[model samples]
Target chain A: MDLAAVVVYEILYTIAFLALISAGLAVVFGMMRVVNLAHGEFVLLGGYAAIVSHNTLGINIFVSMLVVAPLAVAVFGVVAERLIIRFLYGRLINTMLATWGLSLAMIGAFTLIFGPTTTSIKAPIGGFAVGDYSLSGYTIFIIASAVGVVLLIFGVLKYTRAGLIARGAMQSADMASAFGYDTSKVYMVTFAAGSALSGLAGGVLAPLVGIGPTAGLLYIAKAFITVISGGASVVSGLIASSGFFGIVSQAVTFATNSVIGEIGLLVAAVILLRLLPTGISGRFFRDRL
Target chain B: MTLNRRQFVQGASAAGALATVPSVAMGADSIKFGSILDTSGIFEAYGKPMEKAHILALEEINAAGGLLGRKVEMIPYDTQSNMALYTQYARRMTRRDKVDVVHGGILSASREAIRPSLRKAKTLYFYNTTYEGGVCDRNVFCVGTTPAQQSAILVPEAIKRWGKKIYVLAADYNYGQITTNWIKFYAKQAGGEVIQADYFPLNVSDFGSTIAKIQKAKPDMICAVLVGAAHLSFYRQWAAAGMKKKIPIATTTMSSGNEHKILTPSEGDGIIVCQSFSPQADFPSNKAFLAAWKKRFGHTNDIHEIAASSYDGVRLWAEGVKKAGTLDRMKVIEALESGIGYTGPTGKVTIDGKTHHVTHDMHLIEVKNQTLTIAKSYSQIPPSDTQRVCNLEKNPNDTKQYEIKI
Candidate 1:
């Protein structure tokens, strides 16, 4: 029936949303072991960058979201890694504290510029009819984007020399350095890549949520939940956890309403963590990335 | 003699006590009007304008030769959108600053947080924000449009224009919950049925699934009671899904914080929002108020329902003080209870002596190019919903927010 199709679409969209938001955190936390608490703020900055470019500079919405937001955030990521994150390397607790402070500073900086009001651009795509029901065409774009991003990450890590070097550096910096690789350069590039993914997620989701100074709070908890619950294997774990949480949340949302849906997602995450502390990937996808 | 530790502390304490005496004496020369609002946080959109409105009102009152030959001094406190600070500042304003009268509490929770303290201190409180109404406190005056004054008029009008199957999407809070009930009450009166009602927490901005759900229900119209910055997304997402053109929408909380301006012209246009005030209201006093605001603040862009109501609230309190001829708490209360009214930008806001609430004119407005265009005006709708439960005359000691059961 039309209802079933719409529900399935919603479930897929939710999964895509979770994956998109968590992809960057998975790379930074799971792969780098850095635990970037400012992951949410990085996403927030991307949204603001998209809005500023599209609304103020009169750039095409798609171009601003796709190119400008990620590039801007990637540049910031490089600077941040150089100035603060570099010194805090190999110190997990210190990185968390430093990133948390960075998050607060980003929020303050954003409020100074944007003045605490919600700002957003209109969704590029309009709704299209699906049988008897109509849904946002942007939903399809988001699902596709999520798929592309996951594949892109997977392809790079599985094939490219840079991705191989980055993975090797993350696994054993001493071994990679002995192989004549600059581990520092690898860390910087990996961090920037993670930040860019977060930016892309923020840009894609901007039309739905509208960007504000405190907007990061909405996605931070969910991103952390998804990434942490996914365990150590970045791509496979992110996919697995995002899939489980998103389906549970969206199905509950459809059955009841959004409040209970959110509660349901949180409850599922809690139970999942209790049962498998190392996460879904820890137990199931042990050797898969 | 060498000073011991206890004697040295006593000497410093005495000096501190002596320093406070002169400051307290200086403060007594002018009547202190305390204003508390969240001027620097997420709620700043609602708070900053309200603070400006209060200043304008106070300035106007003082410019008219000072109330009772004594200058009204403002003692403003920024609550910073924190509920705990509301209580902290309320106590400070009443006990430390000893303000004669206090105005400003943006959220209903903020008002509730400080209302009892103000009542205990007998500092004469005025909460000037549109909220769920059922407070029967004789000590406080609520000068905002309640559900009866808003939803009772908006729902029926929307039902008459659109079809009968009304879909409700309200925020998950007392304001949204109670307002949705009022909408239902009025919708039934107009022979309409709510096809579905959904509640969203203030932070849930994603509405993709909800949009699909709405399409499935196929309601004639959507009645939104959403609030805050996050809830603004529903409007954006609803339009993005191209549902705005297909189904008309009506809301009770739009334009209060200038939410219409936040959305783009295409997205916001054709949405109906009923409120107690509109900047476009054709009134001489409104024009003057806007002119004064422009002259003082350099722009009238931020003037909205709650801002305008805040202006009227301060003016009404000044009127009560002038009539009483003294700032005595009981005397001013008596004067206010004598049906004090002020005709300002909102058009004749009169205190309902019975419930200590206000009866004001409501305007049904449509958003056109990011501006509210007044389509129809209903005059002097009382807080009938609160009136049904609250009777301050009979039970003067009553201090409870009664939730109306449908």
Candidate 2:
């Protein structure tokens, strides 16, 4: 029974981790249809921001992770959108090429600023007992944060005027422009918001995986896998696919080990994509936000 | 003769290429010491200091009236943490520069890339880094501690201090796998049993499931043989789970890259490690080395075990050359094969002629407040693991890295 609880906790944590990392990609790619190959480096930038603030500036851990990191990355995202991403919009291959180049540049810049060493921040939460076993309290925090981020995104999109305008512009830029909406402004804000979400995830997860210049490589494939497999709708699609992956990956990890478990996740994704090319939301929750 | 513009340019370029070829072979009076290291890119944290140590050692030699009463010149190539570049640079150093000796190769993969070419050219090579032992090559000298030098000392000592049941978390690579084998061997010999062993890939940073499994197994102690930046998260997650207070941890592969400094004092404290060098080591030679490093580099913060080893490696080769009184590769090998020893920063590091590995002092260290404090010292631990499989004295043509059978 104790083992079962730990397994459940691990599954939840995995689901939350997948959801957290994919939230921003779900916006930029799922909604805006812009493939930001540099998504991982943006996350890495956020992690560096968090570490520098907390470790060097003597800031509170929460403020550094939640506030400083997001703000720093949001500013960077705005500049990237204005300077590089703006020109490459609507050309899928060109956007990919530009962003890929941007990824290499960001990696180089990070290596120059941070140096080539793994930097880490201690997790603030302590352990809490569950039956005979103790698990990280930070796990619970992460799960909560993931849920909060999803709900916040859902709430904004469903209820706010800005979110509606942004969604409309993404769906049909010409139609939105004809209706007197500044679709260009909407794209800029939406991209910045997506980058902020990524930065937030990077900040929160920075304590778990020590921040390095190439640390984003660890999360990039997994994040892209989650977002791509989520299909059309950002919220419901993300939830559906991440739920499937999180359960399978963690259960396999428990049955065997992590390396095989990772293989199992990839295999499951391949089979899933093969069967439903449009992804999990393509079949179910097609219209639900 | 009057020539067209294009023909003139081509002739000038051809002449320039011809001129450049012999520049590498210039300075016939000095010995060309070819040094290759990843002074940039991903492995720079490890390679940068080792490069610094190379310069420091060379400058010291030059100050002492040079090797063989002639200036020992260095030819450097930055591999930039790329594997392909290792072979490319090794070939360049051997074929073009025609360096008399070569020193450097951080990762095992990097070492393997350059080793064959260096051997083919009959150039004496020195790889100064800690790794899985059993490199049985007559032409190569591996000066770093092996699995036996570290895990053999750590496991039994950990079993005595903690209880009998042990658990291992090793990286999913040859180094981690072989080190785990040695740990198991030493554990059983010391009347302790490994409750479980888990191998993690270099990029597996999330340890939630692994941590929970460890809690269920309830091992008396944990031995981490994890490596790289991603695996460093294990230490952070382990500490976060409050396991630091419950299960004592011993590691064979921590602080080699100054990982302890990466972790906070609370996270790093009480971790047991066995290595050859610690900045806090209390010895005259070590002190002098640190003093010299501070003067040269402006600080000693970047120096690690491999930096010390690299410094010693160059000095050891210089000694061999001094004894042989020649730059001829065979003569230097013969002189070094007489069991060359150098008491440098790591304290009396000697080359075992049989295995081409080191027999050196190993320190039992504990981490407290992000500092390595030496608790016990074991002097001159032989390269028994490699020596069992490698005997270059009888078979001088051997060139294979044996996997020591448990």
Residue by residue across A1-289, what tens digits does model 1's lDDT show? 9889989998999999999999989998889988888888899899999999999999999999989999999999999999999999888889989999999999989999998888888889988877877678888999999999999899999899898899889999999999999999999999999999999999998988888898889888999999999998998999999999989999999888898999999999999999999999999999788
For model 1, the stretches where C-alpha displacement exceeds 4 angstroms are: B1-9
lDDT string for model 1 (B285-371, tens) is 899999999999999999889999999999999999999999999999989999999899999889999999999899999999998
Query: What DockQ does every candidate get?
Result: 0.73, 0.82
Q: Which stretches of candidate 2 lie over 4 Å from their true place?
A: B1-17, B20-25
What does candidate 1 score in Cα RMSD to the true structure?
Answer: 1.7
Q: Could you tell me the lDDT of residue B153 within candidate 2?
A: 91
Model 1, B140: alpha-carbon shift in Å?
Answer: 0.6
Candidate 2 C-alpha lDDT tens digits along B112-156? 999999999999999999989999998999998899999779998
**Predicted model with the maximum DockQ:** 2
Q: After superposing the true interface residues, what Cα RMSD does each candidate give? A: 1.2, 0.8
| DockQ, computed on Cα atoms, for candidate 2 | 0.82
Give the alpha carbon lDDT tens digit for every residue of A1-289 in model 2: 9899899999999999999989988998999888999999988888888999998999999998899988898999999999999887889999999999999999999889888888878899998888888889998988998999899899999999998898888889999999999888889999999999999999999998889988888888988899889899999999998999999999999999999899999999999999989988988888888
